[model samples]
Target: MVMTKRQIFVVFMVLVLLVALVCASHVTINEEEEADRILQLPGQPKVSFQQYSGYVTVNHVAGRALFYWLTEADHNPLSKPLVIWLNGGPGCSSVAYGASEEIGPFRINNTASGLYYNKFSWNTVANLLFLETPAGVGFSYSNQSSDLFNSGDRRTAKDSLEFLLRWLDRFPRYNQREVYITGESYAGHYVPQLAKEIMMYNKHSKHPINLKGIMVGNAVTDNYYDNLGTVTYWWSHAMISDKTYRQLINTCDFTHQKESNECDSVYSYAMDQEFGNIDQYNIYAPPCNKSDGSKATRQTMRLPHRPHQTFRQMSGYDPCTEKYAEIYYNRPDVQKALHANITKIPYKWTACSEVLNRNWKDTDVSILPIYREMIAGGLRIWVFSGDVDSVVPVTATRYSLAQLKLETKIPWYPWYVKKQVGGWTEVYEGLTFATVRGAGHEVPLFKPRAALLLFKSFIRGEPLPKS
Candidate 1:
């Protein structure tokens, strides 16, 4: 039967509805991703928090924001270090970790095990501000769905700078503080670019932000080095076989010069040699292994057993911890705080390993130039990595850093605390790189003591304690 255009339109609409139902059921965590909206801070400390509300219109999209916990040091009225914290997931909430977990005013009590003071908290030493950035990560929101969709390193940094302008106006007191931007994970890219933007704005504006220094942990500053470093980290931890290591190197191009497909093939082949499941450290999807008795069964059956330890600990590795962070993230309010939402959507508290696979965009921003500019402008920069992070392995960080051929005066040396050594530090062309012992991507979570000391030294503009 011949049909009119109107009849065809109705038929097409029906077909679209059917497909929508099927895809909606398959809507994964990434698609359902929404920011953890801030209601109120649960506890009280000797801190002041005025929710900084601001709007940044980017590409005609207006983003609403909330920043928490602002204070001025007692003696340093005119000047003090202003620190900004960012949590990386490309879609994760900074308020979740920066505020509640790592280094804000208070920590959420998870179990009956009594209240745990975030002893390694960064706020004790600096004026810390936790921002839920971009349009959709946390308490920050936008009516524009496009604002929620695409993101990359560049856009995130730009949005953050804009957010700060509104934030500074909301709380104008701390504008003169020596600003230092710091964060972990994907923030490797976030911190440097924001620092650069602040400096760029300072050049033109009258009341410029007195920017000082920047810090990042287990940073994803460089993609190539971080990727190759993953294999080295896996091998050190004994997660992979020597045969697998050889296979990885042979298959993958560590240079990071080639397309991602070529690198994926190498990583994919090495993963196939082991259990047929996704290797979270390396981004390659898992292959099926029949003899391994299915991943779920092996995982369930291995419950009461201890997995074989692979990597030999370096000189100062603490056996007791290294596993404490995994234990900490599993608690309930920690879950609630991380997943707090204004809109009704299911939110999981744990960090998403395959974050980019979600609706989040690969930020097209290049932060290397930012880092270079910061160095040129005499702003001190520190990039630290926790040795045990699988997500953004320290080894991969080393690879990423190799791209910056800053003239090296000294080889890597150990940074110390009291009489005990904390981690290694490398100095090249006015930039500092340090490693925190027994920590992961989130430096404060696993090794708060070291993390605190690191910031204390940073705020003082002192060389990190020498070993």
Candidate 2:
């Protein structure tokens, strides 16, 4: 049937847009850009920027490799710096938690059947690289089988450096680019150690990483302070009874390398009082169960491997994100599109790896010295906290920073985002600190706009917006 002039014009415009979209989405990874290119994600929306997902082999002997997802900047491809993100469980997938849940370009739609654009994606300003590190975490794995048992802070740093060097070899254009290490939770350990390794790498090379800065959100800087702050936060927030609180302080040793039986008992009592029904990660968040007794259950990937830790707590406001991501990633089409699980690893993909967490070799190392060293080297360091987090609360971070005893360059003050107070901030001689007022452990997931403002400020080396 022949169409009218108006119909023809509309159809022509539609075809033009489709053509433009194909052109925009068809980002050619130059011949030098190695690894698998993402044709498209299963439920992705039409986007202008390109995304690549695949693995980088860090160890040839152990057949060890790490998975990464790279999302290029929205506008400038060549001019933007690369920011690498890691999420810490000592065993978490940066792609699942950081990329999909927090700051990536697309967030899983509520139905888990499609995608939606994140208004506050970190990719607005720079290229974002999310890595699932230490082999055996997320889609990253090792063929040699013995790798997981040896997982430790030092080993993770070494492998991460190796992965970076090899990955940079593939994307050679980023050689002259300034790279920043950014992560949260245990990445408090990962970021500083990796940066230290990069610093060492720079000493031996002419064309180095051009390492610029680091931004950590609610990071675990010191064990003693972190532990002390947790119990203190619980008591102050009225989550625990005064009796249990007093007993915890009197009987428990927060700084103990390994908690004694007595200490564990006291802590267990405290936890029983407050954490049974509430989400420990975010104290105020609702549990899987309710007073009405309706259950909001999460599904698991439950790979054939020995059961370890539950891959929970990545979601911020959405209580069911763990279930959603598990379902989305497990789809066969999604895996093929992303070039994932080609090796047919024995287990289903999980957001957090229990095996890695159980095998984690170092938990007592205080990273305060790493901070001191970074500060002394004139690196741009910033630490922000999500005020409502119980896992690694803002109080813990403040106490950890206090251990630094750095000279104060600026006193504490409220910082704003879009005329609203985002949180408070304080700047030391070599570091800047800020907090997200009402956010939980996963700040960006809960407060995207404020988190983006915080990130933009961090990336620009400016203070958090103070209007």
Question: lDDT: which candidate is best?
Answer: 2
Candidate that would win on TM-score = 2
Model 1 Cα lDDT, one tens digit per residue, 1-467: 99999999999999999999877654632232222233333333343332322233343435344334343333443455678888765655565567655676555453322234455566567666777666566445555556555655667778788877766654555667678888887677678878878888989999888888888887766544565677777777777788777766676654442335655665555455563344332222232233355432111000000111111122232221212222343445433444433343243323222233155455422356667788889998888888766667777767667667798855688887767778888877868788886665566755677888888877776667776
Deviation in angstroms for 264 in model 1?
A: 4.1
The clash numbers for all candidates, in the given order, read 12, 1
Residues 1-467, model 2: lDDT tens digits? 99999999999999999998877544443543534678688778889888888888888888998988899999897899899999887777887789988999988876789788997999998999999998988899999887877698898999999999988877877889989999998899899999999998988998788899999998887868877787788889988888877877787666755667877777666665555666655666665442376654422212111111222343445666766787888889988988888899899898877788767676535889988888887789999999887778888888888988889988889998888899999999999989998887778887889999988888888877668
Report every candidate's CA lDDT. 0.59, 0.80
Question: Which residue pairs does candidate 2 place in steric collision?
Answer: 309-354
Off by over 4 Å in 1: 1-40, 43-63, 66-79, 111-116, 253-357, 364-366, 409-411
Residue 187 lDDT, candidate 2, scale 0-100: 91
Global Cα lDDT for candidate 2: 0.80
TM-score of predicted model 2? 0.88
